[model samples]
Structure formats: structure tokens, C-alpha cells
Target: MAEREREPAGWQLEQSAPEAYERYLVPPMFAPWAERLIDATDFERDDRVLDVGCGTGIVARRITDRPGGVGTVVGLDINEKMLEVAETAAAKSQLEIEWRRGDVTDLPFSDGAFDVVLCQQALQFVTDPSAAFREMRRVLGPGGRVAASVWRPLEYNSGYVELAEALERHVGDDAETMMRSPFPEWTGEDLGTLVRDAGFSESLRTIEIGSMRYPSVEEFVRREAASSPLSEPLGNIEPDVREALIEEVRNALEDYIDDEGIVFPMESHLLTAQR
Candidate 1:
């Protein structure tokens, strides 16, 4: 018997990865965390601010919207597609944000150029986070502050654990690896040490606990895949395999599901310091 071939309707993302990321992931996960990261710093109205790895300009946009507004808000990212989306969004809102495409490890700016450096959920993806931290410190003036956030680990994010295991079982090791890459295995003390080694002073690491909610387990899987590199692979997989993967996650997260949808607690290490 031949298995029928059918594409899951939810798997169809009729937009670019960055666009989907802005539509799906930013609102739920990144935007709220952006607020927390901003709160960790002494962001003044007239201070020059730089948002490292500013995906879709959430943090940059938020800074401009703060009371009395901000001065010279710049958002830097390595992905051109993300920068394009960010530029368009800022222009639409008439925001004077400068979107620059550059690497965090080597910022294309002069020394002591910014007053505050804010990175939200991006330190983990850097190939050399310590170098990136040093660059952040270099761009900050004396008494400037740097605030960044990184997911604690997979163990602390149980929903992702179930999803990663299901991906390995049904998709492949590569898919599982892609899903788990965001959650770094670094402790709070390790984050403090990294920034201190990079010449940051008075480093403070705090564990911020938050929750993410999806309309359902299926939407959770669908949105996560659509917004990330997994979109192509998940969209290309056999429909039955995709179904099994979602089902496994659904069963595993049944306890977390409620009348609204699937809700799970997420944890991250917020590191703040002065340069």
C-alpha cells in the first residue's frame, strides 16, 4: 500500500523566515524579554543606545517608544533579511532607527560610541560570545551599561526538551540540534565571568522566569518551524512524520495544556554590567 502524500496546512509559511519571525516569535517570546533587558540598564532619554543582534528591531523600537524617547537608537544584526524587515517596520512607524548589518564580535563602530548596549536572546548564537562581549564593552563609554539575555539551558525549558526529542525521533539529529541551539548550557556564574573577563565591571546575573503560550501544541510546532531554519526541512518531511512529531509533543506536554492552549515556563539568565 502506498502512503498518501499531503502537505499539512499549518506547515505552509507564505513569508520569509524573518517575516515569520517578526509575526510569530517576536510578539510572544522576544518582545517581552526586550522590556526586561531594557529595564536592567539605566537607559536615559538622551543616551546613544545600540541593540546587538536586534532581530526585527523590537528592542530598538521599544527604546524609541520609552518615556521622553531615546537618542540615536541603532539596531545591528548579521542577517540582511532581518535588517530589511526591521528597516521597513521602523519606517512604517516613522521611527528614526538606524539598522546596520554587522557582526557582534566585531562591531563596525568607534570606541566609546554608545551609552547603553542591549542584547536580547542573541549571545547564545554568537560563535565567540566572549569576543562579542568585549566588542560591546569597547563601544561603550565609561559608566555605560550592557545588558544581555541568554536562555539558561534545555533542562529548564521542558517544553523545548519534548519538542527537541520528538524532532530527533521523527526528523533527524540536525533538526533536533537546530531546535536546541538557542538554549545554551551556561550557568549564571559563567555569564558573570564572561562579561567580567571582557572588562565589564560590576556584572550582575539574574534568572528571569517567564512563560510562553501557544494556541495549541500544533501551532507551537508550526510557528517555531516557520520562524526558524527548520521551516524548509519540516515542510519537506513526510506529512505522517510531521504529524507524529507534533503528536509526541502534544502527549508529552498534555500537563501544560489548558483551555486556551499550551503554556510553558521559560527561564533565561540576564546579565547586566557597567563598562
Candidate 2:
């Protein structure tokens, strides 16, 4: 395997994973997707909104920034570190958002507490998606709606597939599993059934296609590693092993690289349901 001379500077900073996620992944990936998910639903001015699993509070912040503003936006995530980042970001933006550390399966809110519940790229990680859906429905008011987005499958997200395969080869199976966990193998029908079983009445599912770009393949691997559970594992590996992993990803994703950087198509299932 080919190796680079040195690992990129600051690659071993595992303590800043959440901050890295907000700074790196949110702009290129989550923030744009959050706009799409928010566009799919109708949010009236002053409508109470809850963003479930709101990493760094991008969706919550966006909703509050919307033209007429919203009513009582709350951002909830199980990871306190992520919530800390979310709080900091919201504070920086001078946006008033409640950051709550709570589990998705059992939300900490009263019944009919929100008019709109928005979840972006989080349902797949839930141990019990059905329970999470139930909680979403339980907290929504009469005629309220829930909007959530989940990556379609690994096959549809080519960039991540290559990255996961490279991690399996160089890092370990656990690393590959961690990388691929975001893109579940659930179909649109499967997601609809999940919401329906959770007592949501009217449901709509759509496929949203988008692109993710990185300055280079190395940056791609480095930023993704820095932002996720793979941070410590990748940082702990031998420097040469890390270089080889990046080389593998570069070779695999060559077709997607251009003058700008590495760019690849991604797909997700956007589901909206009413309670």
C-alpha cells in the first residue's frame, strides 16, 4: 500500500469531535439537507417546533431564522457533547433555542406539545425507530405533522460506501459499521409503515437526492473521521495505516474527483406524517 509522508495536522484532536462535526459536516451535508427537510413541511409562524436528534442545532436554528420566526423551538439529542456544541452555536447566532439532552425513543415533552416535529438524519441510529416515531406522534398536537429524513441505503450513497469499505480493509469491521450506520437499508415503504404503526395517520415519503463535496479525498476521510465515533480509532492507528486508508479511498473515489475536489451523489428518504 502507498503511504503519504505525514498525517494531516490536527488530525488527532479527538476532543473536538462535536465541534468538528458542526464545522465540517454540517455545512456540506446536514445544513443543506435540513433546508430540504424543512421545505417539505409547512411551518406556520409561531408554530411550536421540536428538532429531535438535533446535532449542533442546525435545523432548530434554521426554523427560528425563518421569515416570521417560530414559537418555542427545542433541540434535543442524547449526546450531551453534541448538545453542548448546539448550545454554543445557537448562542453565537443569538438564536433562542432550548438544547435538551434526551433520548429519541422516549422524548422529554408533554403530549401535544409541538405543532411540528423535525428530525434530520437521525432516525436510523435509534435503537427502536418505532418507539421514536411513537414519541414523535405522542408529542405532536392534533393535526400536527412530523418531518424526518433518513439516508436511503449504502448503495445509493457511493462516497460513503467507498469510505466504509476502505475502513473495513484498514481500520476494522467496527469502523466500517460505524461509518455505514447512517444509511440504513430501509425502503420508503418501510419508513411509512414505521410511522403508521406508531399511529401517524397521513404519511408522505419522497427521495431527496443531493451531492457531498470535499476539498480532496484526504480531507474527506479526515473530516468524516474527526466528526464521528471513528475519530479515536482512526487517530489511534499507525500513521502509515491512516495514509494507506486515504490512498484507498482516493483510488476508489477517483471517478468522482474533479478540479474542485471529491464530489459524489447522495440519496435519502424524506418522510412527513400527520398525527
TM-score of each: 0.96, 0.95
Which residue pairs show collisions in model 1? none
lDDT of 2 at 263: 94
Query: lDDT tens digits, residues 4-67, model 2?
Result: 4223554665558999999889998999999999999998877999999998899999998888
TM-score of 2: 0.95
lDDT of 1 at 24: 88
Off by over 4 Å in 1: 1-9
Model 2: residues >4 Å from true position, as ranges?
1-10
lDDT values, one for every candidate: 0.91, 0.91
lDDT of 1 at 238: 77
lDDT of 2: 0.91
Report how far residue 126 has shifted in candidate 1, in Å.
Answer: 0.8
